[model samples]
Each structure stands twice: as structure tokens, then as C-alpha cells.
Target: MHYKEAKHILSASNGMNLYRGCTHGCIYCDSRSTCYQFDHPFEDVEVKVNAPELLEDALCRKRNRCMIGTGSMCDPYLPIEKTELLTRRCLKMINRYDFGVSLLTKSDLVLRDLDLLQSINARSKAVVCTTLTTLGEELSRIVEPNVATTRRRAEMLKTVHEAGVHTGVWLCPILPFLNDTEENLRGLLDYCFDAGVEMIMNFGMGVTLRDGDRQYFYRKLDEHFPGMKERYIRAFGDSYQCASPNSAELMKIFQAECRAHGVRYEPDDCFAWLSEYEDKQVAAQISLF
Candidate 1:
């Protein structure tokens, strides 16, 4: 891990990544795509030492409060986060300033800040987003080796839900010929439904492969699923979006299950919910007045 002083913290849309690289090695991580242009190795996490201070300044200067998002580019709860506590410090600022937050992660370490998340939710909104790609623990280990398994993440979702915080799941990057099966999809959706997640965001039963990430993913495929790399090369042939052949059938089942379970499956609706800032305390104050 290394530290860098970032000049800015929040994006135009109010999203921020406290760290640049990720240690929770998801083999299909889109952030590792060459389009992102990382100067260093993906696991050599680049900690934004000034993230908390910069976020405080940014939030303080904003005329209107909005959701402060994180973990889009890198998982905030990476192993380094346990000691660095940058994400925790930033959350303290967000809570102090009464700003909403939308945090995305694949780690159960997020449970450490349950109290702060609850506090923020009580004031405004605090929605937790977790990714569920593979349901089988062994498959999860092979794919997202360093991060929490899908079952553990589902448990974390339940924990967040019981804390009165809404949760969303990113059911994405489904590898073709690997985990792009109806069984895998159903198993993952069962977890979401059981955990009481408010919404699920799935682009399709497919994963994208690009310059940096494609090479890495193919290398992993070679290592774990022999002859799979050749198959991908033969099938995709430098294509960017590698849609699984089961995409149509799987999406039908996905939508049907979500509807049956009363879970939000529309991507736009889920994103709107995540981005919307609701101040329940403010509403209560106005009611009292």
C-alpha cells in the first residue's frame, strides 16, 4: 500500500474512491480495464491520504446536500481499510454533516461501521450495495479470491437490513461458460430475497472483457479452467462485451424471481433510490414545527 495526496475527493456526481487500487482481487474487476489507466499494479493499493480532509472540505462547500458515494472504483473495505480507517473517517464526516451515503463493497468488513451507517440512515439515507457474482463458495473463492464469499456477503446484507439500512446487490460480470448458469443465478437471487435486499442491479448474464482486465481474466481462466482461454478467444475474438449464451433465458428467470419476491430489478429505479437523499429527521422537524 502507498499514499497519495489527491487534489479533489468527490466526482461531479458526488462519488469518491478513497483508494485507487483494490486488493480484494475480483478476476473480472472492470476497474482494472486498461481504459482506467492504472500507473501501478492493481493490488498495490494507492491510498488517498487526504481523502477524509478533502471530502470534509467538499461536503462543507456544497450548497445542497446529496448522497456521498464510494467503492465504485475500488472496494472501500479492502484489507488496508482495517488500519487506515480512511473510509471510516470519511463516513464520520458525512454523518456529522448530515449527508447521505451510497457505499458499494464485496467485503463483510463493512459490518464494522454498522453504527455509523445506522446513524446516517436515521438522519438521511445510507444504502449499502454489495456484489453477488457467484453463489457457490468454491467458485466464489476461485473468482473473487481475496474478498468475502457470496454467502458471507448475503449475511452482511441481512445484517445491514436489520440495522434499518437498505441494501442493493450488483449481480454482474457473470462469466460465460463458467458461472453463467440458471442454477448460479437462482442460488444468488435466493440469497438476495432471503436477505431482504431492496433492489438488485444486473446488466445481464454476461461479463465485459477489455485490454487490462481481459488479459488478467484470461490468465486466471488458463490457471483454473484449462482450455477455457482458447475457448474464449475462439468465441469472443477481441470483443468487449462477452454476453453469455444463456443471457436471455437467465434474465427471464431473474426478472420473474425478482417480481415474485417483490425485489426491485429495474436498474434505473435502483440507481434513483441510491442517489436520492431523504432527510427523515428534517421531515420530522418540519412536522413538529
Candidate 2:
């Protein structure tokens, strides 16, 4: 890991990435796509050392408070974060400004900040979002080797929900000919439902592959699932969106389960809800009759 002084932290939409590049080793990371143009190796994480200071400045200048988001381009809880504590410092700033927060990650290390998350939720919204693509431990290890397994993430979600903080799941990047079966979809949905997640965001039942991402993914496939690379080449042939053949059936099950559980499933709806800030302290005061 190396430190870089960032000119700014938050984006126009209030999203920020405290770091660039990742060590989670998810074979299908879209961030690895050539469109991102990384100057360093994917594992050589670039830390924005001034993220907390920049975020505090931005929040202090804001005329109106809104949700501060992170983990779009990189996971805030990357292993380096165990010592760097950049994400925690930024969360402190968000809490200090009374702004809401919504962050996404596949690491259970997020549990370390439950105190800050619960404190923010008491005054404003704080949503912890994670990705769940499969339930099989072995398969999860093969795909997202360096990150927390699916079961562990589910437990983390439940813990966060029990802390009175909202939790959401991103069920996506379902690799074709891999964990694209109906059973895999149902099992993951069961985990979300059991955790009582507020939403489950899913774009489709397939993964997108670009020049940088596709090559790395295919290489991993060749290493683990022999002959799988050839199969993908024959099936996809340079296509970007590699929709699984089971997409239709999985969609049906996904829709049915989400409706039955009353969880938000639409991407637009979830995004809107994540960005919407709520003042729970005022609501509590109003409830006092």
C-alpha cells in the first residue's frame, strides 16, 4: 500500500473511494476493466491519505446534509484499513456532520465500526451493503478468495440489522457456467431474507467482462476450472454482457422471494433509498406524545 494526497474526497453525488485497487481478489471485479486505467498493479492499493480531512471539509461546506457513500471503486475495509483506519475516520466525520452514510463491501471487517454506524443511525441513516453471489463455501473461496465467505457476510448483515442499522445486499456478477444455477440463486436469497435485509440489489443474473477484467477472469478460470476458459470463449466470443442461460429462471425466483419478503429489489428504487437521508432523532422527538 502507498499513500497519495487526494485533492478531494466526495464526488458530485457524495460518493468517495478512500482507496484505489483492491486485495480481495474477486476474479470478476468490474473495477479491473481497462476503462478505469490503473497505473499500478491491481494488488498495489493506493491509499488516499487525506480522505478524512477532505471529507470533513466537504461536509462542513455543504449547505444541506446528504448521505456520504463509499466503496464504489474500492472496498473501504480492505486489509490495509485494519491499521490505516481511513474509513473509520471518514465515518467519524460523517457522524460529526450529522450526515447519513451508505457503504458497500464484501469484508466482515466492517463489524469493527459498528459503534460508529449505530451512532450515525441514531441521528441519521447508516446502511451497510454487501455482495452475496453464492452460498457454497468452496465456490466462494475460488471466486472471492481473499474476502469474507458468503456465510460470514450473512452473519455480519444480521449483526448490523440487530444493531438497528439498515442492511442491504448486492446479488450480482453471477458468473456463467459457474454459480449460475437456480439453486445458487435461491440459497443466496434465503441468506438475505434470513438476515432481514432492507433491499437486495441485482442488475441481472450475469457478469460483465471487459478487456482488463475479462483476461484476468479467464486466466483464473483456466487455473481452477480446467476447460472453462475454452467454454466461455466459445459461448461469449468477446461479448461484454455474458448473461447466464439460467437468467430467466433465476429472475423469476428472485422476484417472487423479494416480493414475498417485502424487500426492495429494483435497482433504481434501492439507489434512491440509499441516497435519501433521514433524521431519526427528529422522528424520535416527534413520537414523544
Cα RMSD for candidates in order: 1.0, 1.1
lDDT on C-alpha atoms for all candidate structures: 0.92, 0.94
After superposing candidate 1 on the true structure, give the runs of residues whose Cα lies further than 4 Å from its correct spot: none
Per-residue error at 144 for model 1, in Å?
0.6
lDDT of 1 by residue, 144-263 (tens): 999888889999999999989989999998899999998999999999999999999998789988898998998899999999999999988999989998899999999999999889
Give me the runs in candidate 2 sitting further than 4 Å from their true place: 284-289
What is candidate 2's lDDT per residue for 34-111, written digit by digit as tens?
Answer: 899999998999999998999988999999989989988899999999999999999999999899999999999999
* Best-performing candidate as measured by lDDT: 2
lDDT of 1 at 191: 94
Instruction: Give the per-residue Cα lDDT of candidate 1 at 208.
Output: 87
Model 2 CA lDDT for position 245: 87
lDDT of 2: 0.94
